[model samples]
Target: MPRKPTKGYWVRGHFVAYGSEEDSELKRAAKWDADLSKTDLKKRSAHLQAVGEQLLTLKPSLLQGLDLPPSLREALAEAKRIDDFEGRRRQLQYVGKLMRQLDDALVATIEATLAEQHRASAAQTERLHAAEHWRERLVADDAALDAWRELEPDADWQRLRALIRQARKDAQVHPDPAPGQAQRKGRAWRELFQHVRAVLDAHESPSTVARP
Candidate 1:
């Protein structure tokens, strides 16, 4: 009887037999974390599949900027359009296969892009929180204006004062709640939040202001 044939895929014209010594070396060279075994290979495949799924969620302009093969791009594009459950699973498997063919550098680029986007999303949340904090303080205390002025010396102080005054007035007037409905502050409340957000967006951070 003939010996069982090895199973693998080709990488850059070289056939990489799964879980073989050569496979382990290539993985190490690519800076992958684990020693290759049948199990590790499965984990690697699943990881690549997850990365491929993340690629599907990439913005269209960012996706276009990636240096991907035409076939992989088409597969990713098709995966987005697939509405059928089984069909998407099969298409994603195909995407995972293509992802494996990518060189180590391109894989690093994909990871970096995802990480950068994550940081950007976090910064946006932080900015919104900072704005809310300032808006609350300004509406409650006249002294908060001095702290805000120190942070943004170039801000339109008069405009901020007008918004804060109106927001405070709106906050003091309480109306009876209708059933489950909460008390809604007037437009100035919203405008105060927006104004603070604009100032915060223009600067790095309140703590980083050119402190005396």
Candidate 2:
């Protein structure tokens, strides 16, 4: 007769025989988990549920890249269509359960993706601010042109200088009339902003020149 196979479960690609030391140790760890207070478990559940909810806000492109299980993805999609508050809550709870089943590596990847998106958004806002600051400085200070030339050596200096000069003249002629009046900036001011933004964008490869 063929030998009987060992009664065991595979863990981390190893067969853990039933009642073996490794299996006993694993059971002990589980016992510790079982001993956790209900309050602690609830808190952990709530945190995981919140992370699951964040998937709804994720961009479609980013969401598609995640290696989520079919059941969890389906649950999330259904949750979005759920108009009833109670039903949606229940669906999301299901989502949380599925999230808990995800391997730590996948969870880490999700966190990293969210962080990357956040950083990109912040960098875009910073770039816009830098362009605006440069435009103002270029108009107010003549020496700012030389500074800008150093920043973007290949930029068309003649057009930039003309735009700056016209922007300054327009500001002097049409100052912010009063607190209640609309902020009326001339065409040159807007053009200068566009120019600065273009230069900053073009320079991102060699070096980021859009600093305040």
Candidate 1: pairs in clash:
none
Model 1, span 40-159: residue lDDT tens: 777877888899899987777777788998989999889989999999999999998888877779998998887777776777788888788778888878888788876678878788
* Residue-wise C-alpha lDDT for candidate 2, range 9-108, written one tens digit per residue: 9998989999886677577547647987778767766777888998888888999999888988999999999999999989998888777666668888
Clash list (residue pairs), candidate 2: none
How high is the CA lDDT of each candidate model? Answer: 0.80, 0.82
- Per-candidate RMSD, Å: 7.2, 7.8
* Model 1 stretches with alpha carbons more than 4 Å out: 1-35, 174-183, 205-212
